[model samples]
Target: MTVSRVTLLLGLLLPLSAHAAEFDGAALGAVWALPFAGMLLSIALWPLIAPHVWHMHYGKITAVWALAFLLPFAGRFGLATAGAGVVHALLAEYLPFIILLTALYTVAGGIVIRGNLHGSPRTNTTLLAIGTALASVMGTTGASMLMIRPLLRANDNRRHRTHVVVFFIFLVSNVGGSLTPLGDPPLFLGFLQGVGFFWTAEHLWAKTVFMSVALLAIFYAIDRYWYAKEDLLPVDPTPDTPAFGVDGRGNIALMLAISGCVLMSGLWQPGIAWDVFGTKVALPQLARDLALLAIAGASLQFTPRALHAANQFSWAPLKEVAKLFLGIFATIIPVIAMLRAGADGPFAAVVDLVTSPTGEPLPAMYFWATGVLSAFLDNAPTYLVFFNLAGGDAQHLMTALAPVLVGISAGSVFMGAMTYIGNAPNLMVATIALNAGVKMPAFFGYLAWSCAVLLPLFAVVTWVWMR
Candidate 1:
């Protein structure tokens, strides 16, 4: 949207900001979730059924769905409450979320791995393993952006290389990110809620290893089968070089700085906070955001243009994410409020699924419940929902209810591979592959791949571990 429209919308909403109050979830009906469902459905179906329209007018479409909720919400509740909800979503959630993503995207895009190796089955397995290792260090977004071009270039000569990208999403984009907050948004949300920095890595390392090695093994077998068909191009599109090295190495330091900023926010608490439309804006968070913005600027200013060109980096994907997630965050306010209400609210059935007859939490049920929703909804907020449902006490969760937290974390991070829309980087990787002439599967086709390969493994995980 244009700046003028944004200004006007803020103008309308800010008048009652001082009177902002939280939504009463018990009072909200299921109908209030329509806009959230509509937004998700539009994201899923619109692209498949009407690619042209969706591509051209997704921003406008997102705006419509957002307004569909906002207008009705204003009429049902008072204008003050609606305005506060928007303010909270924007200030507390959306801004920090988008800024961090943009910073990661910019920094990672700058680091280009030049030249290529032949995409042998061994070589492919090794690359996937390296990416899986890096996912926790540099973030799934950063690692995916940095690794995808090299992987694509390596396989450009092969005819049946789409499976390579699919497995990349399964391993590097999702499961590999299970080990740290920087690796995935959901884990970061956990960090923001007081989960320790190394907590996920400590708790989830074994699970991550199991999933990553298993997927890599499966990929190797499948890739060898495809490789045996020997459908090679007479001449490779991207000829292999004697040695490959990386450009834009400075972004590595910037990434570390970004990591430091994130860690600082989690560790440094000055006991100072400001209330903006009923949202708590902490000093550390503000400082971290400003530092992140500066880091992104530094990356753009210092990185050479040729590196970005070679990477084929564009802001289009980030812009699409920013717009679509704005609608998602806006429409999801009531849904989250309802979920937060537990048994008294509209999502009582969802609450029941994770709760035992004796009112105890069920780790196995938490695993499936969080995973299934995460596959279809935004995994970050899905993580938050289950986190809250499991009693949003981070210290208690880390110690007494550690198993339940494990289920929630693993589900949010790993099951994101189940669909293109499940995680931000899943679609981003698919788009990159498609642009490089890899014929990626449609949304449902990818779903088939994930379910066939992933469900059995997840079942094993539940039986042996979570249960």
Candidate 2:
């Protein structure tokens, strides 16, 4: 099902003959829908093929998919500039966003610790709450990285540790990332697209409260059972270590430097010029390049050798991300192009279902659907599509639509933890966990956790806040 075919089919079926011409079959197929469709097909087929062809893990296979799809851009732009050149430019420009996210994950992962828990369940619960709160500032990835090791260390003497990590993923890795734009890239994309920076904070109170409460309750119950079991074991008196300490205070500066570079990259705006193809070409801004260079430099210079010493700072994580995202980028290019061409097609029908009597959009429904799809899609583009859709109405509707946009943005970031491919950080967390000998569940398996645990909490959030 190529994008053009889908567009042609939709064009013939739509009653709005006046708008039929908007669907450009070839362009639609090539640029809008193909990339996403390709990604789905590739993910579905990769496992069957990977063992024989590559001897790679599923993560590495995903990376390969991203790279193969993305490689064409470099080739076309460098030596054979044409239609392909334009695509290469587009993909290359977006590459830095992924790198920025990877850096965040690396820093977070480095700070985590694993030890035995000696306090009451309430004490551990308080710590988890504090850690999740920190996720908003340090990034869910950073918070997860910083805390997972400690949580694991705390439970090292116990056999009942799996549930603790599971809860951590739900609260810290996924839901906790919603409060700030810096906490999640998808929301940051919303910020770049004219959605205000503080928008989420103003609007997400209900979601934050709901997920927080539900996760805390679930953790308490689970932790109680585990605590009781631990009481049966003989207590060994080990020297009491300090609750927390800033071991590498110097590293904080490097962390800030890297973070600053990432911030500058997000704020970079390229200059636009008319091109030979009758379209605008936006040249990369100096800030964008410099920011990336600074981040790369910092990662090389500041990362402790012992920190990366165990695994040799293997390119595996980055490599895997590149591969999976390539397939995603290429596959969805055409799909998005088609969707943009026919803004009021079947998809619009879906959107219209959520509109209110006064033509006001419903924030709760929009938030849920957008968030859910973002778990599987490239949320940056997904955010753009929804933003354009919601913003396309008269300017007067902006106020009415603001909450909807916030909901979408918040939901996308929060729920991205639902699956490994939901957001970049999810995969990074998984990889780092794997490196630490904690095997994360498979794609669908992880989603089951979210569906059972997070979705109900999100429902309550939507009811209380977004409704």
Candidate 3:
């Protein structure tokens, strides 16, 4: 993590000046991906097998996998390639990703919703709809953190509510983020890769609206069935207030600033750049990241202390994200590289799966493949891999390859609901729900819910849209 350590690792592990970009993924075998696989396995199995060890040393576990990949990588392919990759992952990819998330998390957590209404099936579904709409504005994490406690408060009296939280993940955490880059990490990555700021909203609007409307409708029917089964024994724990409204509204300005900064970075092209190690830091992007940090700081100063208290805002969730993603970003570098290498790389079979024999992009295959991998792996980089495989040209993807891009976008965002680990926000929402006294399902148990409800809806989506 230290500069000197990085210097030594890069200097000795790989050839001097050799960057990951110079490393030919085609020359590397599937064995190079073991560390990434190990990292995924660590995230998936550790918590289930040893809760104490995983909880305490998850960072260390992730670090081990990262080192596993880095040390061997340096030894095999020197600076000519891997150096570019290592620097890019850190400076360009990981740093910006984490910063934006932190900024959104900090500001959104300050805006708490107060005075919850009773949790009727209609009310719950309506709240889901609103949160889904809000996700594009606030980012999924912001909206989820803001609305989740009120949702918990509303449903505290209900005998059965896990189903409500499950649908919340489907709609708010995943599908809701489809319209904008700020809404989800994957889309934001596309923004960084030169996609237009509103490109996702432009091309993905239909699918986003479709999924949001359909999911809301399904949630309503299901919640009605579950609500009918609840008895009168459980009393609502939330203290009734005169009316429903929101507090910490000042954060709205900060949220808009966040969105504006993203848009400006895309629109204002100053073509200037800085060389930091092997990564090319563009002037506009640098300015945008600085502005984001300033906005987060301003939000902290401007928002009242009472708002943070009301929200019960804490740094624990963000810290958890920081620790886990360090390992993820590091280990995933090669996987992304190899994936970008296309049919010549170790994942050739995977490449072949999403392509027709005549070499056309199968939008449906792209959807399922991207979605399923994203369900288990980190959705953001998984999206990048497929994005590159489909040709990493933002202009081309947005125009000529629009359908393929849609399939990729819908898959990465929508199927993140399939598992708690699919998207970062899914687990956070589940955790907040649990802390608020909801008996959330176990890992696999939650997957059952997704398989039963969300998958069928996704099938419908693929049929109507992707096909």
Candidate 4:
């Protein structure tokens, strides 16, 4: 693929400019506030207008939302050129990482669930366990997509199977994704912003343990309930079964190749070796990224089409992801740009609110606010805003702030289960489930499940660990 010079130049320039000079803290804070305000306005008004003005279909509604969000980017671009003398000046470096994370998770998800079409009772339980583990590595989206199809297939003979997928979304797609940066976009953003990769892993262990236990417990109970309900229904002991087919387990190699590519792309950063558009740039981190891409490209040649056939390799899932996330990319650009321009002033009050009573440090409030906003707005930008705030001080406040940061990370990834729009994977799972004839609950209905189930567990997390 021919790389766009424009894109390459912009990539080289933006980071240089961001690092070369700092903007007014007040301006940056004000800009950051716009998105938060917009998020509130969007969520508040979406309900009233969603029923009457927008189509109920997920694709169409999400498309409209994307367009609405993009308008601000155009304005920001013009404003930045005129006044700030910069173009695409927001903290946009994380966008590619976001895309990489989304794609990696999607592919990983597809791999985990490929084999268990028409899962038996034993298979369903196994899939849940496997899917949960996959959630920590490939991400909730990756695990959810990989497992959702087989899960639906397992319950194909039953009538009360919709709830199975709902809880599946809650477990594998959202809450389970909280354990690592690989599990959620917000934390990945943290990594790019100088937050160490192992920091979240180390700090969030308690929250992860708490939530994982809670989700597993809930899933087991629900699975049992549904299992009993299945027993009451007439059994199709002799139902027609699809032919058992096997191919080279080469897809596992392919999956690993893809994952390496994604991880490298995610961790790659521009360095000072490259120069473009009057700026010097460095990107030594691209080595790992290039290697991963090379592996993926090679897999296309080395892996036979027959393996993909068994996996039911259709482009539809990736296509849907591309289409929707493109809209997301377009819409949030301006929102984030504006936030970057003026985050310090408007968000200062929010920062104060997040501080400890003695004006020392408070991580708990930081986690709660960041996590809550992450549920609606893209978590990447939310992470950036908080990171910038936290990094501003040269002093080591990690001990004080670490718990809060972990809280934020966990909350963002876990609570993404609250709505279809909460995280990319949540919607993907819903789409796949619906496509397979399982009707997911409405937005508010899903929120009710999260509140009743996830919130209590989160409280436990706060008390036991974050406090």
Give the number of the best model, judged by TM-score: 1
Q: Write the per-residue lDDT of candidate 1 for residues 196-282, one digit (tens) a residue.
A: 999999999988898998999999999999999968998999877877798899999999999899889888999999987677999
Candidate 4 clash figure, as a count: 26
lDDT tens digits, residue span 74-151, model 3: 667654455666777877877788889989998998887879688998889888988999999888989898888888
- What is the C-alpha lDDT profile of model 2 across 365-432, one tens digit per residue? 77877777777764555565565456533232236666777677766776776776666556656656
Model 4, span 1-467: residue lDDT tens? 01253244335434444323323434432443443445444543564467445224535555455434334433544322322222222223433453555446434423433333544445666667777777777767667766776677677766676667777877787766666666777776665545655566677766676676677667677767777666433663335455643344454665566556545544565443543333232353345445545544555566566555544556565554444444444444433434333325544466577776577546677667776776665455566555555552212434556666666677677666766667767766776777777767777877777788777876777677766
Question: Which scores higher on TM-score, 1 or 2?
Answer: 1
Against the true structure, what is every candidate's RMSD?
1.7, 8.1, 2.3, 5.4
| Model 1 residue 415 CA deviation in Å | 0.8
Query: Between prediction 1 and prediction 2, which has the larger lDDT?
Result: 1
Alpha carbon lDDT of residue 246, candidate 1? 84
Off by over 4 Å in 4: 1-22, 28-95, 102-123, 231-248, 258-272, 275-281, 299-344, 392-400
Model 4 lDDT, full chain set: 0.57
The C-alpha stretches of model 1 lying farther than 4 A from their native spots are 2-4
Q: Is candidate 1 or candidate 3 better by lDDT?
A: 1
Among all candidates shown, the one with the greatest lDDT: 1
Cα displacement (Å) at residue 30, model 3: 0.8
